[model samples]
Each structure stands twice: as structure tokens, then as C-alpha cells.
Target: MKRFVLLVLLVALGGGGYYAYRQQHSAGQEARASAVAQPRAVPVEVANVELMTVAEEVEALGTLAADEMVVIAPEIAGRVIELGFKEGESVKKGQELVKLDTAILSAELKQAQADLGLARDTHERLRSLVSRGSGTQVSLDEAIAKLASSEARVELAKAKLAQSTIVAPFNGVVGLRSVGVGDFVAVGKPLITLTNIDPIKIDFRVPEIFLSRLKVGQPVSMRVDAVPDRTFTGQTYAIDPVVDINGRAIRLRAAIPNADLTLKPGLFARLAITVDQRLNAIVIPEMAVVPDGMGKMVYVVDGGKAKRIPVELGKRLPGKVEVLSGLTPKMQIITAGQMRLRDGSAIAIKDKPLRTSQL
Candidate 1:
């Protein structure tokens, strides 16, 4: 009977321990379920919606061109006696640039002048005799005709003499000369090149769709591979009235001040034309934007939870973007830790909120 009592007590103790263990296990599972139901907040970085100045810009490729360029050539062929200009040097308008041998031209001019003088004397003598009724009217008429012809010859000779000397047509820089002193050149042969580049012009083409936005006097900025460290600024001066049929583009020209003469013609240029600008525009960092199926979305912190909001995008800046719609100022936008976020997911800010001015 004593042994039976001991066995029963031991069984009862084991049963109590098992019942307690079951209760504890059930409670632990319930705690785990509760924890899952209420997840911890996701940490993120946030910034306020920015209200700043923004510009609408269009980009294009172009080539630099001189304001005025011309090939310096002679109108009359002759032996080049003297060159009045040095290559790669600046010259003034009407300055002597080249002189051709004018020995034959000068002699012809002098003979023509002597003939004009003789004809003038004969015409005068015949006029006097006709007035006094001593010379026939026909003779006077012949003398008058001869005098006119002689005068015309003299004028032609003078013109030919002037053509032997070439003068600069405009203020510009002279390029390399193809012919030098003592070199015989033919008529219309290119002697050198003259370029006027103080106020340089750049020609670029833009798509026809941008025609309405483009106009004269719009500000433009440009960069070139040759001048990497500097950015040149100018304004649109001309737009082609007719669209290019082959390329469906409109040609544009801008004038840039190049007093220092740093920008050279034929250099490849990258152009940015500012068509529109706004002083008060809503902006946000680019990283805050998320791509949805066909649209874009961003997360905004509202009441310690992330609320995904769709946005209409505008022109993009360096690392920021303009918000055209669906967002207002002072909204906190998540810039980081967006991968784990869903609509209405709880968020814990990891740092101080950045203001628009700070951006």
C-alpha cells in the first residue's frame, strides 16, 4: 500500500509539470503572433518638398561659326609684287592687303589720259569753229563723240589700275596666305581667308516640335569640348521661318560675345536654351521617386507612416526633379529606406528632416 501511494504521487507531479509546459508553450506562440501583427517601424531618411526656381531647358548640338567669313581673292590677274598683311594677324577695314605689279596698268592709264587731253582740245577747237560758223556741224559731232570715248577709256583704265591693289573689306583676322610676294596669281584665286569673330555666332537645329517654344532673345548656355572649363552664354538671334523638310528641324542662330577670342569657329558645341522658367516650383530629390507600372510614385511621411503618392513629373535638374502635380510644399518625402516600405507602412525617421532651403 505504501508503494502504490508513492507511485501515484510521482505520476501526479509529472502530469502537473506537463500541463504547465503546455500552457507556457501556448502563451509563447500567442506572444509571437502579436509581435507579427504589429511590425516594428522601418527607418528612413526624409526631406521636405522644395519650392525653388526651375527652368525649362532644351538641349542641342551645334557648331561654332564666325560672324563673317570670306575668301580673299583678286579680281584681276597679275604678278604679286607686295603682300601688305601678315598671316594670322588682325587687320582694319580698307587697309591695303596685297599689291600686284601695276607697271603695264600705269602705262596704259597715262596713255589713256594723254589721249583724253588731245580729244578734249580737238572738241574745244571744233566747238569754237562751229560757233563762229567756220567748222561743219558733222565735224563738231564727230569730235564730241571721240571726246566721250576717250573719257570712257580713261575711266576704265583707272578702274583697272585700282584693281591691282587689294584692300581689306572688313575688320577681321587674316588666315594663311596661299600666294606670297613675287608669286603670279590668276583672277579669282583665293589668296587668304578673313574672319570676323568678335561677336561669334553658333548655328544649331532643334526639332520642329519645339518651334512654338523657341523665339528670338531667349537665353542660351553652351559648352564645347575644346573649352571644357568655361561655359559660354548668349541669346537666340534668329530662327528659320521654313522648317527643314529632310530632318523635320528648325535652324537657330545665337550670338555670343567673344571679345577675348577664346571660342573658335568649327568647334563642336553643346547648347542649352532656356525656353521657360518659374520661381516657385515644387521639387524633390530624384531618389525619392519610385517607378510604378506606367507612372511614378513617391513616399510621403504622414502621421509616422509612409503614404505612397503618385506624381506628375516635369523638367529634371541635376539630382532633383520638378513635381508638376500631386504634391505640395512642406510634405516630408522619404529619400532613403524605401525598399521595405508599402502604402501605410510605419516608418521611423533616421535623421533630422531636411528643409527645402537645405537642398
Candidate 2:
């Protein structure tokens, strides 16, 4: 009776375990089947690529420099007697910038003038005496020598006086003052830096590949990060004859008009130089094109599926880019759903494109 009871208990426990396992397995299979039947949520959008002409431009970082930068220095040693211009002052050509002590020079000039007058009188007298044969030839010759010596002294004195006053060489803005009133200055000492700021220069370089397309007098647009919201317009002024051996780039310079003095010297700038103008080029939104490992590609929606098509990219513009090849005038492209798409993946166009109003 004990054995019989044990056997019955064992059978009951085994049967109950088997039934639970079967129920759990059946529930898992149903859940998996339901999940498989449900559709995946995919976000999608559409774009149309149209052929339009786009201008090609090259970009580079550059610096704004003065057209002419000169360091003003004293030519002769003297004590500063007067400060004609202050720091950061604009001066015109030949304007007096600083006055050095000229008291000694002035006295020397007065002496020279007196000597010159005396010599002139003596020379006149000698000439008259020589013509009349009242004076010896030797005496007349001595008088002539004295007159020439006096004239030379006068010239030397005038040169000295001129050197005492420092003048501006050209029209420009002066930098900080290096010497003050009563300060002694030496020859070759820098007084200040003078810079011609009107119509400044922007120096930039372009890749050698653009050598054929680039030309002198091409229009360039410049922007400086130092001053926000301001763009300086300019044109290509010059191009180097030879390419840079190290960088393999061609140096180019542009002249920018700084009428309001908004652009300053030594400020960093970014330049956009239009090298070529395409009359009729295919343009599409930059985001519409996707970059694959091999090359740049874009998906064209045809027969409700994404068709992976490779493209040749050209000049890039703000928010839009130009396609050199692999597109037509009117073709629907997948723009927004690229992240979730692969080759030949099915796509559903969500909403119609927003129409742009023509002016």
C-alpha cells in the first residue's frame, strides 16, 4: 500500500510539470508570431532633384592686411620737442607727425645764412675787381672758393632742419606713439607703425586644381569672425605666377574696400572665391545626398523603393549642392529617410513637398 501511494504521487507531480512547460511554450510562440505580424515604424520623407545652374566657388581661410604697412622711424637723433599726432591718428601725406628739437639746427642755419650773404657780397666785389684788373687773379679765385663753400654750408643746414621734423610718407592711420614730448630719440628708432587701411588686402591660397578656372579680377566675398554680421565685398587683385612648392597651392590676393574702417589689419577672414560659373547645372539639397564608403550616393525613389545611385559632386552652396552627374531634370529623391534606408529598401512618401512661392 505504501509503494502504491508513492508511485501515484510521483506520477501526479511529473504530469503537472509537463503540462506547465507545454503552456509556457505555447504562450511564447504566440507572442513571437504576433510581434512578427506587426509592421515596423519607419520615418520617411521625399525630395525632388531638379537641374539648375550653380556657380562654383572655392573657400579658404585668410587674413586681412594693410595694402601698405610702414614703420615710421626717425632719420636723425634728437630730443622730441612736439608731438604733432596722437596715437591711432589719421594723417595725410607729407603731414608733420613729430617735431624734434631744432634750436641748434636753426642757429646753424642762421650762421650759414650770414656767411652766405657775406660770401655773395665778396664774390660780387671780386668779379668787379677782376674785370677792372684792380685785384689779383689769386684773390678773385679765393673769393669764388669762399662763395661755393658758403653755399654748401647753407644746403647742409637746410637738410639738417628738414630731418628734425618727421613727416608722414603717405596717407594712413598711425599706430601707438613710441616717444613722448621731451623724450630723446635716436636715429632708426621706430616712432610708430603707419598703415594704409582703405582698400585692404586679403591673402589666400587655392588648390592647384583650380589653376585653370581661376583668373584675375574674379569677384570674391570675405567674412571676418571678429566682426559679426558684416561681409566685405572684393575682387581678385593678383595671382602668383608659380604654385607653392610645399602646399601645392596657388597664392591669390583680393582687394577689399574698407570704407567705414570696419575691417582692421591682421584680422582673420574666410574667403569665398567664385572660380567658375555654370550656366545650367543640376542642384539638389545637400542633405539629400548620402555618403557611402566607396563614394557619394543618393537614393532615388522609383517603384516605391529606394534606388541607390552614385553621383559626382561639384560646387557646394549654402543648404544646397550641385550634382555633376547621375541625375536628371525631374527625379524624386529620398532626402529625410536615408538614415533608416539601405539599397532597394521600400519607402512610402509621407507628405507632399512644400511649395516655394515665386516672387
Candidate 3:
């Protein structure tokens, strides 16, 4: 009875061991086959980078300057007696600006008038005497000379009196006053400054390459740093005939209308001039390009691989760039995931298409 029980237990143990070993072997084979059948996940993306040819544009930065600026100065020296206008006041041409003390000039004018009256009487007497042969020719001639000299002195005194007052030469805005009442100023000293704001001039510079594009009356759009939202329109008034040899640039002057006096001289501004226009050109997002040390290039995707292609770049606009060469409209390019890729790298396509806004 004991031997029978031991034999049954042995049989059961052997059967259990065989069953466990077969199960383990089957699982191993199944795992190997599954590993071979399943595809590896290669985190990747797809981009349809197209080739394009775009227009060429040039950009430049410049400053704004006055079209006409001048300083007010006294031609004759005298004490300032009256200020005709306040500082920063707008004055018209020939408007009175300053008045000088003319007390000495007034007295001199009075003395000349008395002298002229006496000379006139003497001249009349001499003429009558000469006609009657009672006066010598030499005496009549002396009297005539004295009368002419006295009249000249009277005119000279009146001219001096007129010089005592200063007037504006043109219509402009007056600047600060350098002198006040009772201040003595010398000749050629600056009394004030004035600037013509109407039809203001804006001066800027452009590269010499745009020399041919610049015309005498080309329109220009300008914006001031102080007033970004406001854009002033003007036309090119003049171009410097000579180019700056040191900077390789051409100076440009444009006339801007500042009727409201909003634009002031010496205020910095940004200027833009459109050289040319294009009807249709190849344009791409800026991210599609990868700049190399020597040149620029982009990765073209084909047959689940990345192919590096070099390209010639042209004008770069906001968010879009112009491709001069090495691309076509139908070609696909890798815009995203470029950093993780290299030349001839295997790639997998993503489900979603790339959008222009994505870049």
C-alpha cells in the first residue's frame, strides 16, 4: 500500500514539472515573435516645406531733421528796449521781433532836421543872388554842396532809427529769447532761434545699392518713435548727388507736412521706402530655414528620410522669407523637428499636417 502511494505522488510531481517547463518555453517563443512583429515608436513629425522665389527688398534706419532752420541775430548792436513776441510764439514774415533803445537816434534825427532847414534857406538865397550876378560862382557852388550834405545826413539818421528794430525774415516758430529788456547785445549776437515747421523735412540715409531706385519724387512713409501709431506721409524732395564714401550710403531728404506742428525737428523717426513690388513670389515661414555657418539650408523630406538642401536667401519679411534658389513649390520640407535630425536621417510621418500659424 505504501509503495503504491509513493508511485502516484512521483507521477503527479513529474507531470506538474513538465507542464510548468512547457508553459515557460511557449511564453518565451511568443515574446520573441511579438517583438519581431511590433513596430518601434520613433517620435517624429511631418512638415510640408515648399520651395519659393521671392522679391528682394532693402531696409534702412535714419533720423529726422528740420527742412529749414535758422537763428535770429542782431545786425546792429544796441540795448534791448522791448520784446515784441513771447518765446515759442509763431511769427509771420516781416513781423516785429525786438526793439532797441532809440533815444540817441531820435535826438540825432532832430538835429539833422534843423540843419537841413537852415541849409535850404541858404541855398535859396544863393540861387537868387547867382541869378542876379550879385553872388560869385564859387559862393553859390559852396552853398549848394552844404545843402546836399545836410539832406544826406538827415536820411542817414532815419536809416539808423529803422535799424533799431528787428523783424522776422520768414514765417516760423520762435525759440527761446537770449536777451530781455535793458540787456545790451553786440552785433552778430544771436537773439533767438526759429524753425519752419510747415512742410517739414525729414533726412535719412539708404544704402548705395538703392541709388537707382531713389527718385526725386518717390513717396515715403515715416513714423516717429515718440508717435508710433501715427504715420506721416511725404515725398522725396531731394537726393544728395554724392554718396558718402566712408559709409557707402546716400542721404535722402523728404518733405513732410506738419500743419498741426506735431512733428518737431531733432525728433528721431523711422523711414521706409518701397523699392519694388512683386506680383507673386515664393514665400515661406522663417522657421523652415536652417542657417549654416557659410550659407542657409533646409531639410527636404522624401521616402521617409531627410535630405539636406542648400538654398539662396532673398528679402526677409515679417514671419515669411524669400527663397532665391534650391526649392520648389511642390517639394516637402521638414519645418519642425529639424534639431533632432541630420542628413539622411530616417523619419516617420505624423498624422496632422503643419499649419502656417504653427511656425
Please, what is the TM-score per model?
0.73, 0.66, 0.59
Residue-by-residue lDDT tens digits, candidate 2, 1-359: 99999999999999999999999999999999987885443346777776676766789999989998899888889999888787887899999998999999999999999999999999999899889989888988899999999999999999999999888898899999778899998899988889999999989999999999999999898889988797878999899999999999999999999877788989999989988778778888898888789789998887877888899988787898888899986888777767778777767777855233210
The backbone clash count of each candidate, in order, is 0, 1, 3
Per-residue lDDT of model 3, residues 1-359, tens digit only: 99999999999999999999999999999999997786442335545544444434345566666666788887778899899898988899999999998999999999999999999999899889999989888888899899999999999999989989988878889999889899999988998987888988877889998898888877677888888889888888789999999999999888889898898888888877766665456666788788888999988776777888899977887886777688887777676767667787777767676454532
- Poorly placed runs, candidate 3 (over 4 Å): 1-58, 275-359
Better of 2 and 3 by lDDT: 2
Better of 1 and 2 by lDDT: 1
State residue 346's C-alpha deviation in candidate 3, in Å.
30
Taken over the whole model, the C-alpha lDDT of each candidate is 0.93, 0.87, 0.81
Q: Please, what are the lDDT tens digits per residue for candidate 1 over residues 79-185?
A: 99999989999999999999999999999999999999999999999999999999999999999999999999999999989999999999989999999889999
Q: Where in model 1 is the C-alpha error above 4 Å? A: 1-49, 288-310, 327-359
